[model samples]
Each structure stands twice: as C-alpha cells, then as structure tokens.
Target: MKKYISLFLLSSILVITSCDERFEELNTDPNRPGGSVFDPNLLLPTATFQHGDLITGYSGPILFQSMWIQALASTSTGGANYYSNADKYVASPSTPNYIEGNWNVGFSLSSRLNQMQILAQQRGLNNLNAVGQIMKVSALSVVADTYGDIPYSEALQAQQGISQPKYDSQADVYNKMLSDLEAALNSLSASGDQLRNDVMYRGDITKWRKFGYSLMLKLGLRLTKVNASGAQSWVQKAVAGGVFTSADDDALVPSDEANGYSNSSANALNVPDDIYEVRWSKLMIDYLKNTNDPRLRIVAEVPPAGLAANRNGLVVGNNDPAVQIGLPNGFDLRGGSFDISNHPNFPGATGSGGDVAIIGAYSRPTAIYRRRNAPVFLLTYAEVQLLLADAAVRGFVPGSAADFYRQGVLGAFTSMAKFGGETVSASAATAYINANPLNVSSANASLKMINEQIWATTSLFANFLEAWNNWKRTGFPELTPVNFPGNFSSGQIPRRQPYPAGESSTNGESLRAAVTRMGGDNWITRTWWDGGN
Candidate 1:
C-alpha cells in the first residue's frame, strides 16, 4: 500500500506539472505583435461596393423624387414622392435631416475609392484601374453635393497615412472632380490586361472612354448656370470625343434575388398600408394623358381597388378603397396605390403591415423583398446627344444640334431593353421617327418638346440618379420649384443634401469650415452653376 501511494502521488505531481505548462502556454504572453488583419485593400472593395449602394439610393430614387414630384410630374401613390411633401406641405428629414445617417457609408466608399486610385497609380496605368478612378470621382461627387464641402485635396489618404482630412471648397472640389473625370476619360485608352476589371464595359476601352466623356458632359452641364464658359467647353469636348451612344453602355448596377441596393432606398420611402406609394404626379399624368403616351400603361397599373370588377371605371379620386385608382401627383388624402400585399397574421408571426415609416432609416426594417439586379447607369447615348444638341443650339459646337437631337432620341429609345427596362423595337423607332420626323429633328423642336422628351425619359427609366443629375444640370421641363405651391412658402427646392450628421459630429471643424465658405449650407446656398447667379 505504501509503494502504491508513492507511485500515485508521483504520477499526480507529473500530471499537474503538465497542466501548469499548458495553462501557461494558453495564457499567451501579451508580448509579440500578433496577426493583425488590417490590410487596406481588404477593406477597399467593401467600401467601393457600399459606395454604389448608399450614393445610388440617396441620389437616385430618394432625391430624384424631389425633382419629379416637385415638377408635378409624379407623386406618391403612397406619399413616396418628395414633391408630395411639397404638395401637402410637410417638412421631412429627407429635407431637414438630409445628413443624418450613414455618412460613414459614403466615407467608407470614398476611402475605398482613394485606395483604388493609389493602387492603380502605384501599379501603373490600366483601363480597369482607370475605371476605378472614374468611379472614385463619381463617389466623391455624391459626398460633396450632399455635404456642401468635402475632403477632396486631402481626403481618402488614410492608406497613405492621412488621419484627419481638411475640407475642400465646393467650387474647388467641383473643379478637381472635373479634372479627375477628364483624366479618367483619357485613361480609358489603357490597353491589354488593364481592361479586365472593366466590369461595366466588359473589356471595351471605347465604351469606357465614352463613359468618361459622358461623365465629363454631366459635370460640365452641372456648371451651366455657374460657369457657362466651362460648361460649354466641356460639353463640346464630350461631343468631340463621343459619349454613351446607347443605354447598353450605361454604368448601371445590376440587382438580383440576393443583392438589391435600391431596396434600401425603397424602404427608406415606404408608406402606410405596406406600399411603395409613389406614382405618376399630376404633371406627368397630365402630359401623358394629353399625349396619350403608351408608356404610361407599362409604368403604372391601376390600384387593386380600381381594378376590381365593380370599380372597373372608377377614377382615382373616388374614396371607395376597392375602386380607387392611383391618385394623381399631389394627391394624398385618399390612400393611393398598394405596392404589395403581405399577410402578417399567418400563424405565430405578429400582426403584419403596421410598419412605421422612418425617413433616412438605414436598417430599412420594411425592405425584405428580393433584391433586384440594377446596373448603375454611368451614362447613356441619349444624354450625350442631348448635350450635343443643347450645345449646338447654343452655338457652342460645330454640328447641327438638330441631327444630334434626332440621334439622341433614337439612341435613348434603344437604351430601354439594355437597362432591363421595356424596349420598343426598330420598327417602333422607325414608326415614331417617321411620324415625328427630322423635318424638324429631335433637338431643334421647341424647348418644350426637347425638354419634355428628356423629362419623359426620366420618368420611364430606372436610372433615377441620372434623372436627378440631368435635372440639376439642365433644369429642363421647368420643374419650377414645387415650393411654388403652399409648399414653397419658403420657395426653394433643396439643391443638395446636407452633410451626413455623423461627419458633422465626428469631423465638425472641417465641416464647419466648408459650411462657412459655402454660405451657411442652406437650401438656398447655391453651388457653382445653378444658372450662374
């Protein structure tokens, strides 16, 4: 027994010694530099990806409504229209709290753009990387416009070791943006393996070149009222270099079942009754109804109540919910269209459909619909031709604006199918052309015709950002500030969105400096162009 106890005690002692060593090993000495996954490139793509998402939503459908609804062309079938607020006189966060959420989302995107630019420059020139630079400018523009002032000259240098960036003046930023876009346009000529990452163009340098040129045109046009000389020169350059000749060439972000960006924007706009609630505004409906445009049929369907057998002919204004068609633009009192139906009361799930709408809401608590494939439309042939026609009409270019206008119409018409939108065939194009011939051409028509066409295209196309940008540039179709109605007691349409609140609080000093130089950052604080005075 004594011998056995001795052996057992010794074995236990050895076992305890082993346990001590193992424990010491696991308690890792905090001495060595452990594996830190802090690669900039790793975070870069994620930022870039978010860039398209956040910017597209804020600028596209969200702000686009400000223009369309204010123009009285479209409305909130569900109060989803910005101009509906104008019509009803409601102060919205989209307006007042424009800069509230996700400034980081954009800065995150900007950071990525910054990194890509450096990577491309460091690695030498390639079309793919050059496109990255172009996207960088695009992303930054959204930041500047939204916030009034942005970190341009010194921004996005974290990869290069920039911690806190100073703000760049709005004017100077615009200038730099134009310069960057111009370079991006030139960079489109990069050959060979460089074109591989040109996802938008599929290794097509010519298309990238055109995309860059078109962006230049867009930038130039933005300065139309601010710097006619600058705007005119760039527009001429765009025409000379060639621009997006078709919608197929647009830099659209495609959506799908798994990833839909617009869904976020749409959710930020949900109305009561679980519906999207936006539809044709009075101005749009009037014009369409007056012209008897066929497209109206494709874009809008009568409300469920309006489509019911008993309410077959019920006009939109009728109160019988079952027979109510979508309200016209500026009509809100009677609930309008139903986006989709959801039966929340099925089983254990809480009662469905009493969703509280929150503006600038990022979580998009209500957006569960499958994400759709929507390519980001960088530019389009119709837009290029329109710029040419505008320049020609103004006598800024050599060619006849009339011819360009006709081409633009045809080109714009062809873009429909490429965007995953409704398309009319060559036959229809010919018929439309023959019926409305170049005996006048598309461009030389009355400003009303030319402008209306642009507006009509804007209304039908899914490229809401393009629509908003175009409106900002040309102010065509005279979508007089919806503030014109009681909504305009202050009498102004928001020219740009405010800086995201996070940036202001975290990066306050620089943001303040930007605001001071840019005129209090008020809705009335016009940027460079806006008719130049």
Candidate 2:
C-alpha cells in the first residue's frame, strides 16, 4: 500500500511540474511565427494573385460578363451548350455553381485581407495596413457590384462570431468603399517596409497610390446615374489625388505559370469547347470595323481551313482585317432555324463535309490571349484617361475632354502591344485619334463618344466585367439585348446576377431581407448605384 501511494504521488508531481514549466513551451510551435514576428507583407501577394485569378477565371467573368456585354459570343448548342448561361441569358446545370463564385471567392479574399489588416495594425505596419485596406475594398467591390446588396459592414467577421453577416445596401457599400479607399490612399508612405511579396507593382508605393485613386474614380463614376453630384465630388478627389499617368502605371499581376498557376482567362480560352466556339461579337467587331480601329486585325483572327484546324488550339489564324468577321450572339449550331447557317449575311463556314468548320470565318480572339502566363490587367491608364474624359465632359474637372479623350485613345493603343502581338504604331494611333476626335459638339455627344471608346478599349483588353459594368453605368454604345426564347430576363439585359442558391439555406434570414430590400433577387433588378430605390 505504501509503495503504491508513493508511486502515485511521484507521477502526480511529475505531471504538475511539466504543466507549470513545459506545457506552453511544448504547445508553442517553433516553426510558426507569432503575431509580432510574422510579416504582413506576405498577405498582399495572395490577395493580389487570387483577385487576378478570380477576375480572369472561367466562371466569374468568362462564362457571364464576357458574353453578356457582347465582347465574345458562342453557339450554345451540342458540345457548347454550357455557354447558354452566358450567350443566351439562359441557365445551365452548372449555373448555380457559377453564381456562387464571386460571392464565395470575393468574401473569402476580403476576409483574408481583413486578417492582414489586423495583423499589420498590431505590428504598427501602416503601409501594409493601407494596402490591405485598398485590397479588401477591391475584393468586396466585386461582390457588392455583382450581387447588388452584399454583406459589407458585417462581412468577414466570422472570427468575431458573426457567421451570418447582414447585407448592406449597395449605396451604403459604395459610400463605405469610397471612404475606405480615400483613407487608404492617403495613408501610403514610401518610407515604409519594402513589400517583399508584392506581385502587382513590386513594392512601388507611388504606383499603388495611383491604382487606389483610379479605382476610386471608377467607383465614383458608378454613382453618376444615382448621384451625379456625389460622382463629381469623388471624381475631382481622384484627379486631385493623382491617377494612372502612363501604361507603366497600369496594375497588372502576372500568373505564376512556371509554378503551375495558369492564367484562368487563357486557360478557359484554350479549352477545346471555348476555343472552337467563342468568337468576337458582331456588335464589337462592327464598331471596330466602322471606326477602322487599328486593333481590329491585331486582336482578332480567322482560323485556317477545316474543323480540325479551327478546333486545333495550336494553329494561329489569319489576322487580316478583311478576313475578320464577328459571330452574331444568341445563335446556335443545332442545324435548325437558329443555326449560324441560317443567319442573315452568313460568312459561310470554312471546310466541307466531315471536316466542316462551322465558325471558321468568324473572328476568334488572337493566340496572344491564350498564353498561359498572360498578365491580368486590374486597371489601366487608358481607362483612367477615358473616365477623366467623361468627367471633363460633365464639367466635373478642368480639362479638354478632347485632350483627355486623345490621351485615352493613345494609351489604349499603346497598351495593346502588351499582348505580344503586332504593335499599332504611335503615328497610326495618333491618326486614328485625330480622325475620330471626341464629339465635342454637345455634352451628350461628347459623353457618348468618350464612353463608346471606353467600351471598345475594355473589350479589346479582355476586361469583360468592367466593360459590362461601364455599359450599365453609362448606357453608351447601347447594346441590343438578345431576345432568345426562355431567357431569364424577358429579353432585357441582366442588371445583376442572382445571389447564390446556398445563401437561402445557410444565411436564410439575411438573404431574405436583402432580397426584399433590393426589390427582388432576379436578373432584371437594378442595384442601388444603378438608380434602383
């Protein structure tokens, strides 16, 4: 009995000693850095890369906005029927999956950025915190813009025990985004720690400031339809704070293809189905052709003879302007009434018999766009210049709308060379600008011309979502909505995408409240910034 009690006491003493002295030491992970030691700079690259991927991805932009804005069109029949979600405004089996993309990815990234901000603040890393703020807004803006009323103020607070974030109004979201952006832009200091993991600007704080301001300009312009005075105020603020002055200042994040990170846009375009079916829209090509835009040949190509070659992703096509014809939207390959063969003024298919190339004559995007390592352009100097042009026309800023327009045109032409294609000569670009000068005869005419250029520029750059968003805001280059049978929007263009179906199950009450506030959770419902009450 005495021996047993002694043994038990010895074990108990050992455990008590271990708990008091070595418990926390053993629990501490030697490999992991604590909050103070971990560098917040590491978070910026992740947010940057993921955002680049999100925008350029197959689901978010490619399957929806790319066709919605008539930048690219596909025959939604047979092997390519999945494209009906985009081209025909019709749902596919995977439509629910696609709808969840922006909400799921965007909020998750915003949460990561918010985490970075918290850590940076704890460590007194002001520059990193500022970058985090800007990036968080960028991520959240995509969600808010796409779905209308998204969880903004209470979003990304899962760590704070708020699992179901209440959706904020789009107007409130925009106001908060603008305020956050302004504060962040003003906080950037060149003297701070070098951003070791920055993939966008290589730790160039000045360029980051420019990017923030440019984004602010865009967000401000979105309010033009709803609050013109607010738009003017923010536009002036952006200009005064400085904006992208050159192509070099454009925000681009290159895909880490060598590390197995494929450029999603390029990956999607290179897919057999997309490559075989997707082509430049007639709406897009007609405007480019009518203006004799220098980019028409450089950005488009007609595939070689036969179905095999057309479907062959390796074959570079003829880029001659005369050979480039755009495919009409809402057509199909079912060989029925809606077939491309039956369409008016059909530019006959290329091959015959079993090797027939149905869409061979229509202009497909150039091979440069399919390169796996292609840089994702976030925002560019061309867009900034053009937006400034619009502001100028509206008397929101002091400048010649024509000069700003000219700069925008020139910037766009210069930026096109980044695709590793034939460069439009500076002289040729200048000539085009001079030939198609901004229609300064009246404010409306000038606004129309400026925004039309914006549409064209964004389209050619493959920034399809921005193109669609701008169209919604400005109503320029008025697109003819395809009234396909059984479209979700009753022949009207979709104003906003529906919230993901899962929200109804997971965040049911909040989702219901937002749906009610937004009038209804459907495609035709306009957002608050889109002039909806």
For every model shown, the clashing-pair count is 33, 0
Backbone clashes in candidate 1 total 33
Q: Write the per-residue lDDT of candidate 1 for residues 172-237, one digit (tens) a residue.
A: 888998887877676566444444323345466777677777777777767767777887888888
Alpha-carbon RMSD, each predicted model: 13.8, 9.9
Error of 2 at 469 (Å): 0.6
- The Cα local distance difference test for each model comes to 0.51, 0.82
Error of 2 at 267 (Å): 0.5
lDDT of 2 by residue, 391-441 (tens): 988888999989999999999999988776789998899889888988888
TM-score of each: 0.71, 0.93
